[model samples]
Target chain A: MAHLLEVKNLRTYFHTEAGLVKAVDGVSFHLDEREIIGVVGESGCGKSVSQLSMLQLIPTPPGEIVSGEVLFEEANLLDYRQNSPQLRAIRGGKIGFIFQEPMTSLNPVLTVTRQITEVLELHLKMEKHAAQSRALELLKLVGIPDAARRMNDYPHQFSGGMRQRVMIAMALSCNPKVLIADEPTTAVDVTIQAQLLEVMKEMVERFRSSLVIVTHNLGLVARYVQRIYVMYAGRVVESGTVKEIFGDRRHPYTIGLLKSVPRLDQTKSERLVPIEGLPPNQMNMPPNCAFLPRCPYRIARCEREAWPILRPAGGKHFVACHVDVDVKERARETARS
Target chain B: MQYYYWLGGICRGNLGRSLVYKEDVSALIGKRLPVTVHLGLVSLFISVSLGITAGIVSAVTRGSFLDQLITLLANVGVAIPTFWLGIMGIYFFGLKLGWLPIWGYTSPFQNFWLSTRQLVMPAVCLAVVPLAMMTRQSRSSMLEVIRQDYIRTARSKGLKERAVIMRHALKNALILIITLIGLQVASLFSGSVLVETVFNIPGVGRLLVNAVFSKDFVVVQACVLVVAALVAVVNLATDIAYGWLDPRMRQG
Candidate 1:
């Protein structure tokens, strides 16, 4: 079957005053219908950029989709202009987006009903009365309390988590096929992160839509996302099923990421191991592997050759690396010593 | 004693007679009120509509040639004095081009074409600074509002670029723009004083100026009183607008 969405060799660049910034350099991924996946990367890794570029949401002039094909259900999304009616229809009609900073994601001046009903009216051609009822239904579905009374309140009236629920309600109002949640809980309290994710995951499954959770935090998505695409320096360094990535992570950067985050399963005595060094600056990315400086297991080939493309390490597992760092085995060997 | 008497007369709706005009202060101001108000309203409408349009255009096309030209003009507009601009308008439109009259106020109801032509210089002079101010304020406010997450959310919701700007961004931008308008009304009122004299128009501002020189204290007091009252009403309207544009500001 054809992939629900496929991004192949997608390149998005920013023409900054300093120089050209390869914000999303040659990223490729696919999602199946009703499948849930995660794109993992630290800040500035272009995970969010890649997701936003699919909808052409980034500001142009400074930002541009340099070259690439974004195929949504076999249609090339990149063919349409950013302001074209077709593109506009596809944005919230077929594909919904949940951004970070839920506090600010909703318009402060607009009421909950206006924001949610607007999408329904625009996409579904629902009348004012129908849209209002549907918007109320959505708010209740997203677990917003006192739905009727709160419908007229601005974003400021709601707490952070409540606002996020409103955002989720709005995103899911049109029942989009592919829901992209970009660090959806990053700006909220840590206690509410998992709860929000649960509501989101529950809604996605209930709606029978595909999900792509883009985040810098591994722990936040580890329990929810099925497949993982590990990104670094605007490139997908590794990708695999959750089992393959956690049990048999190969890329040095991915291993570093796993160690850096504090896992709930980990013993309290174990010290968190942070990844050394930052990702290369986009303006001055090296021709060779971008992670060579940060990769603890970097080989001479990593420095000499251009970044390696994804090659199969196992079933549905791929890693772009000059060295095969079977992190699990290496840890086992180190423990024996 | 004189001040007490004048204040008491004001309470009774009696502004003492104008010594210079040899008429009742109320009658003199009453006749000229329409002219002043007519000029004020015309100049205000011009400033607000044109200013907001220019600002929105400038913001959306910040790096374009049009944006640059608007910014440049706005900068120069705010810097130019109303009296000087009025003099220049008279010299050019009145003297050189012979397109518009230099002085005097004519109601649009009298002769729309001639009244518009007459209003051109005085209104333009009065509107210049506020227009520039509105342009700058709205541009900056729009730039900030568009960068906001909600605007991006609105865009992502498949809204037409126009709807996204108009429905989402403008309401928020208007909050700040509306606040600036309150201050502008006061400045515009004060501005007409210079502009009216420069153009030799018969309005309350010119009346006040003439009263000051002629030592017609009651007319001067009445002008200040009328202007203060007008400013209060406009500010009240602005506050109501603020609540309407941003419901968050509204009291339950």
Candidate 2:
């Protein structure tokens, strides 16, 4: 069966004064219906840009989707012009986007009701009264207490978590087929993160809409997502079923990310092991392997070969690297020493 | 005391008689108020509309040819004195082209076309600085607002580009625009003094100027009082509008 959404060889560039920035370079991924996936990366890894490109939402002139095919529901979204009627209808109507900064994402002068009802009115062709009633219901679904009264209030009246809940409500207002939450919990307090994630999962399941959580936090993705794609230097270096990725992770970048995250399962006090090298600059990226400078297990051939494509290392697990480090041999050598 | 005597007359709704016009100060003001008000309103309408449109265009199509043109015009607008522009306007539009009257006022009620023709040069002169200031103020303000996160959110909702600009960006940018407009009202009337004299129009500014020259204390004080009152009313309206536009301002 065909996938619900598939991205083929996406490349988004920013023509800055300094030079061109290949923000999302030759990245490809897929999402099945009702599935939850996470796109993990550090800042500037192009996780957010890739999703924005899918909707053609990036600011033009400075940002340009150089080349890409965004296949959704058997239609190539990129084939539609940025301001075309079809793309406009599909964006907020069929697919909802939840941005990172909920605090500022909402129009401050407008009431929460207006923000939510606007989407419904534009896409669903609902009357003002009808859209408002639906907005109240969506607010309650997203776990906003006193949804009725808060609907009339401005964004500033609410706390950070409450505002985020409103954002979730707005995104799921139309019962979208796919919901993209771009770092939805980063701005909130840590205690609210778990609660917010749970509420998000429940809402996604309730709407029967597939969720794509774009975040840099590995731990958040590990707990919430069914599959995870580790992006490095604007490329998906590793992807697999959650278990395969965390258990038999082949990419050095992925391993570095996992180690950097402070896990709760630690019994003894251990220092956090952060990845040593700085991320590669987009303007001056090395032609061969972008990760060559940072890869601890890089072989002599890694510098000579061009960046490798995703090759199956195991069932449902793929790794993009020229050489594979022997896991058993490393463990044996460590033990003997 | 002169103060108490003058205050007592005001309490009785009597502004005393105009020594020069030899009419009740109230009656003199009533006759002349309409012309001044008409000029003010028309000039304000032209300035605000052109200024805001230019600003929105400048901000939206930033660094474009049209934006550059507006910026250049706005810069020139601030530099040219209203009196100098009026003289130049009279030379070109009045004396040279005979397109409009160089001086005097006609009630629109009497002859609409003649009144419009008579009002053009003076109105344009009065509107210049405000239009210039308004353009600069709103351009920067709109530039800031359109870059805001909420504007992005509005676009993400798939609004047509124009709808996003008008509905989302415009309202947010309006508060600063309103404040600038309020500040401009004082300048508008103050500048009108020069414009009315240059055009020889029978406006309140001309009445007050003539009174000051002839040493008519009663008319001078009343004109100042009326202008101050108008400014006060405009400021009050702006504050109320500010509170209404932003709910955050309304709360304690």
Candidate 3:
């Protein structure tokens, strides 16, 4: 099947006071129809920049998508030199975005109904009365109570969870083909996160849209996405199916991420292992693999050379590491024994 | 109930008679009120347009030469006294150049062009304070509003740069701008006294000045009351406008 979206050699840089910050350096990924792909990365790992760059959302003068080809259905979005009318038509209509902060993402002055219906009117070309009616339907779909009456209420009147649902409803208003959820659950509580995730999952299935979930929660992605892309310091170091990632992770960063989580299946006596050292600053990344400074199994070769190229390990799983595969496998075996 | 009583008295034309003019206070207000409104409205329109446009330009190109120039002009405008500015305008445009007539309000119906010509210097003088103030306030407010998350969201939604600033940022900044306008209205009335005296325009500012000099207690009280009432109405309108611009204000 043809890829729904393919971002190739994407480089996003921020021209700041210090120096040129390569936030997303030589990143590439793909999304298929009706498939949920997890982009797991710690903060400042370029996951958010990759998503923002794809949508041409980075602020110019300071930030820019210097090089990229964000191909949607084989059409190059980056080829549009400016904010052409065609690009505007594609944004809220054919491509939707759910931002991290629901409180800030929404216009505080506007009503939930007004926010939802605006896209419907602008993109769908629906009349006011028709758009309003559909807005109520959307509010109901997102599980907001008294959809008709609540339509007139402003965003401040709604709770955090409800506001997030409103944002989701607005994103889904025009029924876009792809939904880019950038840390959608990070702002909410754990219980609300679960509920919101369920709502998002159900909505994705109902709409049959491709989902690119950018998050740090490996556990949440494990349950929601079929494929996983583990990113570190602006590079996707590993890509594989959820089973390959969780069952037999290849990259040390991915393994560290998995081990850091407190799994229910693990014995209560086993303490969670945190990833050591801070994530590298984009402006001053080392010459070798970015995670080398922190990797427990780092060898002399890892320090002396640039990062290894991404190579297929087996059966669609890929890893970017110079470690001896057989030795790591034996070590895993010995540790298990 | 107090407002209603005041409203009834105002409607009954019982604002009391002026001591100096010895005319009904309401009649004096009716005669001079239109002039103040005309001056205030024109000055406000000029200031808001000039200020907001300059502000947006300054914000978009924050550290550029044009931004620095506008900042300097705004600073100069704020520091220079309105009365001093009015005297200089009269000296240069009215006296030295003799390009414009210095005083008196002409009936536009009798001679529209001449009436506007007469109004030019005084109106521009009356506008100086508001123009300077609105520019600074609007620039700061627009700067803050543009930094908001919704502005970024709007841009990410693929809205044009102009649309993002005008529709999203400008609308959010309007409540504060309108409040500035309200506060400036009271000061503008006070400044008009100096302007009218300098230009010799027979507006209420001159009338109030004359009343004060003559110790016409009734006229002084009546003029003060009328100015106070106008200020109150303008503030109330601004408060109502806040609710209109931001529905969140209505709930809170």
Candidate 4:
């Protein structure tokens, strides 16, 4: 079967007074039907930009999707002429989006029912009574207790977790085929994050919709997502199943990322490894490996050669580095010790 | 002793006798208040509606040629003095085109059509600055609101551009717009002084200006106090509106 969504060579650039900032440069990925995928990266690593580019939601003045094809349900969204009606029909109708900071994502002035029913009325063509009932059901579905009473309340009246749930309910109102959640739990506490993740898992499974979780939290992705894509300097540095990524990670940056996070399985005394140097300045990104400066395993060849491109490294795992697989594994093993 | 007597009279709603009109202060205000109120309401209504619409358009189409054009016009409109605009309006519409009555007051209750016709030029003249201010404020407010994450969520929900702007963007921008309009009430009344004088209307603005020139302290004092009260009332209304409009404010 065809993939649920396919993004190819997506390059989203921001034109500023200084120069063109390649926010999402030459990145590519695909999502399977009902599959949960996580795009993991630090802030400004183009993780959010990459997902937003799929829906063409980036603000245009300084930002533009320069080149790419975003294929949803076999339709190319990147086509210039497909802007208004076609894209609008596909956007919330087929693919829903939940942004970071639910405090700011839900309209503060609008009642929860109004916000949810707007999507139902617009896309589902539900009447007022039916829409209101459906909105109440959505609120309940996302685990908002006493959903009927809460419908009349505005966003500001809800707690942060509750607001995030409301946002999720709004996203799921039209029964979208895919839901792109951008750092959905970053604004909430860890306990709330666990609950939200569980709610998301259950809801996505029940809805039978593919979920694309965009976040910097490696631990969260490791525990939740079936497949993962590690992004760096606007490119997919590594892509693999969760097991392959966690067990046999090849890319140095991915290794650094995994090492930086504290694992419960690890001994209490293991010091968290921090990646040295900052992510490269996007405006003047070097032609060679963008992560060369911060890469612990980077060799002279890495600096001499152009940035390595992703190549399948057997069994659903892909790595974008010049180093030999055996040598990289040996280095990783030594670092682990 | 004299001040206490004067204050006691004011407290009882007796604003004292008008020196120029030689009428009861209360009666003078009662008769003149309606004209200013009439002019103020019509001009405020027009300026707010038109200015807000222009501002929304300016913000939604920001950086477009149309946005730039509206912004430029708004700036120029704000800079143009009301008295000068009023004279130019009189020359072009009243004298040259024979379109309107250049100087006079007509009550809507007396003759609705003629009152509307008489009001058109003066109201437009009075509206220019506030309209410009409203447009500028709403534009910036709308631009700020549109940048908000909720607006993106609204658009991502497949809402039409109109729905995204009206339901999401405009509603958020309204609090700022309301505050601006509230602040403008003072200027609107003071602005009418020049506007009424240029048009020779019998509003309180004209009454106040005439009273000032004639050194009628009673009339001047009454008008100033009334204008201040109007400003205070408008501010209270704006605060109430903010509470009504924003739940976050309501909670606090």
Candidate 5:
């Protein structure tokens, strides 16, 4: 099947005062039609940067796409002149983005209707009356009550969840083919987060758009995404079907992540297994495997040489570590017990 | 409070007569008011238009050669004493160049071109302070507004760069610019004294300066009260404009 989006050997680097920080170092992934892909990593692991690079949203001068191709519908987006008017037509019209902070994402002073109608007017060339009606429709579709009255209200008037719904409404107003949601639920409460996730899932399914959900919450994306890409130190350490990742995790980092989450099934006496040591600084990343220093199952070969390439273990399950997959599992189970 | 009430009554045209001029203070103001208004309004128009345009350009192309040059010029304009700048203008544009009349105002009914020519030098000189002040204020305000998240949102919406700056950024910066307009009015009324004296323009500034020197208490008092009233009114207008510029102010 032809992929809807494909990123090949993506490398986004930031030239900082200390050194060149490899924000998204040599990452690659693909999505098919109606596929929901989850990119999971801790903060600063380049999950956000990788998605930003796809949209060419990284601020240039300090940050740049060093070398890569972000292929959307068989076309390399990275090669397009970002400032060109033609490229902008594709941004909101073909692809939509949902930022982490809903408050900061929506323009504060503008009415929700104006914000939504901007996309309709710009890309669809809809008239004011038509665009406004469409905007109200989108607001209703996102489950905002009294959508007509609320259209003229500012972002601050909405609750956190409502504002997030407004964001979702704005994102889906153009019926984009791809929606890139970066930490959409991190700011809201758990209930609101769940509601937002449900709304997003419903919207994605209804629109039949491929969704790329980037978040550090392993549990949040487990049910939402079909394929999961686990990243560490700006690299995709492991990527496979959600079942392969959660059911039979291979990468030591992936296993460590699973052990770290406090499961609801756990007893009151159970202690969460937090990953030891901080993530490696991208500027000072080790020459060999980045996770080797933090890995409990680190071998002599892990320190002496570069880590093994991402290879399929079975049925499209890919892992990066050279250590035996069974050994990593045993270590996780022992730590949990 | 009684004195303020008295002042308010005088402002409402209750004041009787000017001791020095031996004329009704209300009548004196009515006659002289139009001259001052013409000078103030024209100079304000020139200053605000030129200053805001220059400021926007300077801010949008920050750190560019034009920005640096405009900043340098504004600094010099602010530092130069208005009196000295007026005298220098008179020397070059009036006496030396012989392009304009050295002093006086002509009735526009008599000769419209010549009357405008006589008014030009002093008006230009009186405008300098406001121009300098407005340029600095507008540049700083535009800089702050440009950094706002709405500006980025506007850009991301696929609006052209000019639309982002003008509609998004500049509109938000207007409250500060309007506040500066009030300040400029106060400074311009005071600063015009030197220019009016040098040019012999029949305006309130010249009247107030001559009255002070002559110790014409009634005329001086009348002038002071009028200026104070002007400042108060301008400030009130500016306060009202705050609501128009920012909706948050209206809520408060």
Candidate 6:
């Protein structure tokens, strides 16, 4: 399948009074057509920053995309400066973004229909009547019950989940080729998270659009995303198919994340093991491995040299670590024995 | 029923008699109310339209030279007293420039053009302080609304920058702007006092000031009641507007 989007060496930095903070440092990835991918990281891990950098959506005054190339539809999006007509055309019309916090993400003063139709009118040039009907159809598509009647309702009139559904409708309204959902279910309850994810998966399939889910919850995306990118300290520490990641996890960070999550299949009362220490500060990062302090499998070379670059471990699986995977596995077996 | 009887004269539409004018207090207030309303409405219109426009411009172009200029002007406007500004207005437009009448009131009904000419200086003089206030209030309110997640949502929708601002940011900011306007209504009435006195307009403010000086307790009391009642009505209207603009406010 042809690649819908390719992000190469994206580095987004914030110039603050203290110093330059490398929010997204040397990140690179690509989304195949109609593929669903998950980017897992703790809060402030630069997941959102990397995604925002793709559309050039990061605020520019203090925040700048110092260097990066985002090729969408064979065009470098980063080349188009902020608010340029070309960038604006692609931002919502071709590449839609679903932000977190449905409560504050939908305009408080506008009716749902008007908010949805504004996108249609701007990009599609649909008339008021046509846009209204399309917006109603979109609401229905997102499973908003009685969508036609709710068209005239303001955002404040809808419940939190329903408002998020409305946000989904607006995003998919334009049939974007790539939909980036930045922690789409973070603000909702557990029950609603499953339902929303289901709706989202269904919507992306229906629209034939690629999905990029940015979230820290490993469990939530395990079943939905086909490929996974585990981020640590603004870098992709591991990348592989779901089966390879969960079954043959190579990176220590990925293993720690999997262990931290409580499993339903485990009937025994076992305590979840959380990763120790805090994420490295973006401003004063050391030349050595960022996760070295917390990594149980850290080798002497990890502290002496720069963090290892991503290298192929096995069939389409990659890991960034100085320790050999086979050696680490043997050590694990010996320790268990 | 007991409270009604305690204020029986007021209940019966008798506001007592004016001491100096030797007329019914209600009748005297009735004649003066129109003058105050006319001046108040015109000044309010000028101040609100210009103030809101200035505020929106300042907010949208924040960090620009124009925003700094407008903000500095607003700060200076709030600091300068209206009475002092009125005196300066008369000295400049009325004396130095010889552009308008210095001191007089003309009934628009008798001659519309002359009335408009007579009103320009006083109305602007009356509007300055509130205009400055509205600009500051709306600027801050608009700044807050612009930071909301929804405004970012609006931009992400690929809507034109203008539509994003006027439709998304401005509408949300209007709630606070409306409240500011409501508060200004009362301030305008009081502000008209000095302006009316300076321009020699026979509005309620002037009547109240004259009655105060002459110890005409009935006339003074009537003017105060009228101003108080107008302020109450303005406040009620403002609340209704809030409910209309944001339905969440409607439930309560």
Q: Cα lDDT of model 1 overall?
A: 0.91
DockQ ranking, best first: 4, 1, 6, 2, 3, 5
Candidate DockQ values, in order, are: 0.80, 0.69, 0.46, 0.83, 0.36, 0.69
Per residue, candidate 1 scores C-alpha lDDT tens digits across B23-134 of 9999998988888888888889989999999999999989999999999999999999899888888888889989888888777888988888888889988999999999
What lDDT tens digits, residue by residue, belong to model 1 across residues A1-337?
8899999999999999999999899999999999999999989999999999999999997899988999996689999998899999888999999989887789989898999999999999999999999999999999999999989888989999988899898899899999999899898989999889999999999999999999998777888988999999899999999999998889988888988888778998889988888768889777998888887787787788999999999899999998868865587679967
Q: Which of candidates 3 and 6 reaches a greater DockQ?
A: 6
User: Chain B TM-score for each model?
Assistant: 0.95, 0.96, 0.90, 0.97, 0.91, 0.95
- CAPRI-style grade of the A/B interface in model 1: medium
Interface root-mean-square deviation (Å) of every model? 0.9, 0.9, 1.9, 1.0, 2.2, 1.0
Stretches off by above 4 angstroms in model 5 are: A16-19, A279-295, A300-303, A306-309, A322-326, B1-12, B15-19, B98-120
Overall lDDT per candidate, in order of appearance: 0.91, 0.90, 0.84, 0.90, 0.84, 0.89
- Candidate 6 error regions (>4 Å): B1-6
lDDT of 6: 0.89
List candidate 2 stretches off by more than 4 Å: A323-337, B1-34, B109-113, B208-226
Model 6: share of real contacts kept: 0.70
**Model 5 Cα lDDT, one tens digit per residue, B1-252:** 966875777768765567678888667767666777777777899889989988999999888899999999888888888788878888998889989887887767789898889888878888887888889988999988876655655555666678677767787778779988988888888877777887888778888888888787778778887888888998998999887776657673
Clashing pairs in 4: none
Per-residue alpha-carbon lDDT of candidate 3 for residues B168-215, written as tens digits (9 for 90 to 100): 778888866888988988888998888878777777788889988998
TM-score of each: 0.93, 0.92, 0.88, 0.97, 0.88, 0.96
Estimate, for each residue in B1-252, the C-alpha lDDT of model 4 and write its tens digit: 977887899899999998777899789889989999899988899899999999999988889999999999999999999999999999999999998989898889999999999989889989999999999999999999999999999989999888998888887899889989997778889889999999999999998988999999998988898989989999999999999888889764
Q: Considering only chain A, what is the TM-score of each predicted structure?
A: 0.97, 0.97, 0.96, 0.97, 0.97, 0.97
- For model 3 the local lDDT of residue B78 reads 79
lDDT of 6 by residue, A74-122 (tens): 7899998788889899878998989999999998878899988889999
Per-candidate total of colliding backbone pairs: 0, 0, 0, 0, 0, 0
Stretches off by above 4 angstroms in model 3 are A324-337, B1-34, B57-76, B91-99, B106-115, B160-163, B207-229
Candidate 3 backbone collisions, by pair: none
What range of 10 consecutive residues in model 2 chain B has the weakest lDDT sum?
B151-160
Q: Pick the candidate with the highest TM-score.
A: 4
